[model samples]
Target chain A: MPIITIRLAKGRSVEQKRDLARAITNTVVEKLDVNPEWVTVLFDEFDRENWATAGELHSDKYGKGFGKIGSQEYPK
Target chain B: MPIITIRLAKGRSVEQKRDLARAITNTVVEKLDVNPEWVTVLFDEFDRENWATAGELHSDKYGKGFGKIGSQEYPK
Candidate 1:
């Protein structure tokens, strides 16, 4: 069983999560030769305040919100 | 930098989470030679409905709650 955990800045919709879960499951099953039933996809959402890069919290660098529209590194 | 994600049944208190984060951070920093500030620990809480074992949903198999008091596999 492959347990995958994805970390992202919060604000994604349930539809996005559903799509992500499906895509990840498919990839893992194909690559690792595992059953879909054995794959676990976990989304670990982060508040900007709790996430940091280069010793600075994301809230200080990015203000708020998510995705690549205004992000310096993380792309959509 | 190492990003760690912990998947567990929901209902842990903030105090428990804080302790776990500290312990994990220390271990990662020591083992992986990473700075504590560069390590990220994310807790991914799951509902039993979303977790399954042996092709059975955890909710159906374990009922509710967390930890090992009544769990067959997951120990405290």
Candidate 2:
């Protein structure tokens, strides 16, 4: 059994989480052909200070936000 | 490097967490022969509602408490 653990900045509502869990379960069941009941989606919420990228803490870089919109090091 | 993620009911103090991290890191270093810095120990705290065992929610079964001290399903 595959356990999918999602680590993200905590802000989503319960409805959003329910939708996410259902969608993820559906995707996994379709792709892996596993039973819906067997799929476990665990959400690990993290503070910006706990997450670091490019040797800089997200709290220091983003100042408490979920998306990586403006703090792009290289232009697209 | 191996990443160890521990899922548990959240109630431990900061000092307990610090000691746990250090002890785990040391154990990983000794067992796996990896660098201490390379071993990552992430604590994923969960509410009793989110964790289920034997098709029953922990919140409903145990109220609000940590440890399996009294919960003896089978005698040792």
Give TM per candidate.
0.52, 0.53
- lDDT (Cα, tens digit) per residue for candidate 1, span B6-75: 8898877788899999999999999988889999999978765555443344555577777763444433
Q: Model 1: residues >4 Å from true position, as ranges?
A: A69-76, B1-6, B11-44, B47-76
- Give me the displacement of residue A36 in model 2, in angstroms: 0.9
Clashes of 1: 0
Error of 1 at B25 (Å): 20
After TM-score superposition, the amount by which residue A13's alpha carbon in candidate 1 deviates from its true location, in angstroms, is: 0.9
Q: What is the C-alpha lDDT profile of model 1 across A1-76, one tens digit per residue? A: 7777677887766556666677778777888888988887666678889999899997888877788646444334
lDDT of 2 by residue, A1-76 (tens): 6577777775555555566666777888889987766766666788779988999997787875565644333212
Worst 10 residues of 2 chain A by lDDT: A67-76
Among residues 3 or more apart in sequence or in different chains, the pairs in candidate 2 whose N, CA or C atoms overlap within 3 Å are: none
Give per-residue CA lDDT, model 2, range B1-76, as digits (tens).
Answer: 8899888776666787899999999999999998888999988788654544432345555766666733432212
Model 2, position B48, has a per-residue lDDT of 54
Q: Chain A TM-score of model 2 versus the true structure?
A: 0.82
lDDT of each: 0.73, 0.69
